[model samples]
Target: MTLDPQTLLAILAMAVATAATRIGGLVLFGFLTLDRRQKRAMEAIPPAVLMAVVAPTALATGPAETIAAAITALAALRLPLLAATALGVAAVAALRAMGL
Candidate 1:
């Protein structure tokens, strides 16, 4: 499928906008100094963002998803983050395959 000129321009605009935001954030932060509280808050941001993204899906979904989420949480407590995520995905795939 061919993209029209307007579509191409729009895509280029989006790419430019994304790059600008990313670079701007880094540049803005580079010259800043954070206090202890601010540093801690910055560290907390990632997990908070992750929970915000995952909580709704895990809470609203069916038994398979619930079970997978439980597995993910348990594994996360003991295992590395990537391993926990993989385990969660595997559990969900297995459960769905078994028609849970």
Candidate 2:
């Protein structure tokens, strides 16, 4: 099936809007002078957002994968963040490879 011009334009518009929303926040936040409280609040945002995303994913995957992911998160907490991410991804990939 082929998308007509209008359908393609609509899809492109949606993509642009999503991109604008994401990048616009960075631009706006960068220019604005945030107070100390606001800065602290922003600092907490990432981990909260990460957990918001991972929580449902962890729940859906069940106890074992959740445990593995938790261990990965904890390890990442202890070591370099990138290494932890790589280790966690490798663990998940290996589990899938072995048909876990």
Candidate 3:
């Protein structure tokens, strides 16, 4: 039911390591020259990561949740990310309130 200090520390360490690895690559890349192939791959990285993040979150709950999240994201693109997130959360809350 609860995470002990040791387990929590390990989890934190892993998170930091993963972040460092990703950032370290970018830092190192700046000092070096990326070839054409690498550059092309890098261009695709953003969309790939977007999909990687979005696909799972969309499917995590259900179609309604996914639709709500999509609407929130779309709103965030036009408005502030916080406001969009609030809208998405509000949509979910309203659905729950309505007993949907």
Candidate 4:
């Protein structure tokens, strides 16, 4: 029911700092060229970050989710992103439906 001025100011400052750093990275990348390995590493970043964020929660939930996450990871090795994601979703749904 109340908003604190100091907390709001801190939040605004953090937002500005985050925006500045993101824009700065874009500007810096614009002036730089990455070689083959660097390019590949950069391209893999999004998925790596995604897994890092999701792995803990997925594994911690229960056996059903852990199995599905493993299935998804293995599927990702050979299948396209969309297909792998769909398979993972289906696996979890089926497992949960069976009272996992």
Candidate 5:
């Protein structure tokens, strides 16, 4: 499939925007010093963000997704975030394949 000039430009713009945001965040954070409370808050941010993004879909979707999310949460307790996410995805795929 061929991308038109406008589509190419839009893709480039998005790439630039994404890179700028990442670099901007790094630069902004590099100069800041975090205390104990701030560090704790930062530590909490990842799970909170994950929940914010996942909760609605998990709640609204079918049992497969919900069960997958539960497994992900349990795995999160013992595994790294990426591994837990992978587990959730795998669970959902397996459940769906079984016609759940």
Candidate 6:
């Protein structure tokens, strides 16, 4: 199937907008200075963003996902973020396999 000119242009515009947003964040952060409070807040952003993206679907889906999310959140307190996230995924898979 072929995209019409307007559709193609819209897609291109969206791509550019996404790129600009990401690049602009990097560029802005590069020259910015942060005090302790600001730095702490900045450090919190990743997990918050991750939860924002993950929570709705995780909670909305089933008990397995909800339990997995909770396990992951607790793990995050002691484990690295990546490890915690992986644990969450594994937990969900295991729970599903066990027919939870």
What CA root-mean-square deviation does each model show from the true structure? 3.1, 3.5, 5.2, 2.9, 2.4, 1.9
Against the true structure, whose TM-score is highest?
6
The candidate maximizing lDDT is 6
Worst 10 residues of 6 by lDDT: 42-51
Ranking by TM-score: 6, 5, 4, 1, 2, 3
Q: In model 4, what is the error at residue 16, expressed in angstroms?
A: 1.7
TM-scores of the candidates are 0.63, 0.60, 0.49, 0.70, 0.75, 0.81
Error of 3 at 90 (Å): 0.7
Q: Candidate 5: where are CA atoms >4 Å away?
A: none
lDDT, candidate 5, at 11: 94
The residue-by-residue lDDT of candidate 3 on 1-100, one tens digit each, is 9879999999999999999999999899889888999887776555455545766877697766777767765775566556766787898677667665
User: Residue 9: error of model 2 in Å?
Assistant: 3.7
In candidate 1, stretches whose alpha carbon ends up further than 4 angstroms from where it belongs are 54-61, 70-84
Q: Quote the positional error of residue 60 for candidate 5 in Å.
A: 4.0
Taking the tens digit of each residue's C-alpha lDDT, what string does model 6 give over 1-100? Answer: 8779999999999999999999999999999999999997887777777888899999999999999988988887777789989999999999999998
Give the TM-score (vs. native) of candidate 5. 0.75
lDDT of 4 by residue, 8-97 (tens): 999999999999999999999999989999997786665566567779999999988988888888887677667878998999999999
Deviation from truth (RMSD, Å), model 2? 3.5
Q: Which stretches of candidate 4 lie over 4 Å from their true place?
A: 75-91
Off by over 4 Å in 3: 1-9, 18-54
> Which scores greater on lDDT, model 3 or model 6?
6
Q: List the residue pairs that clash in candidate 6.
A: none
Q: What is the clash count for each candidate, in the order shown?
A: 0, 0, 0, 0, 0, 0
**Candidate 1 local lDDT, residue 57:** 96
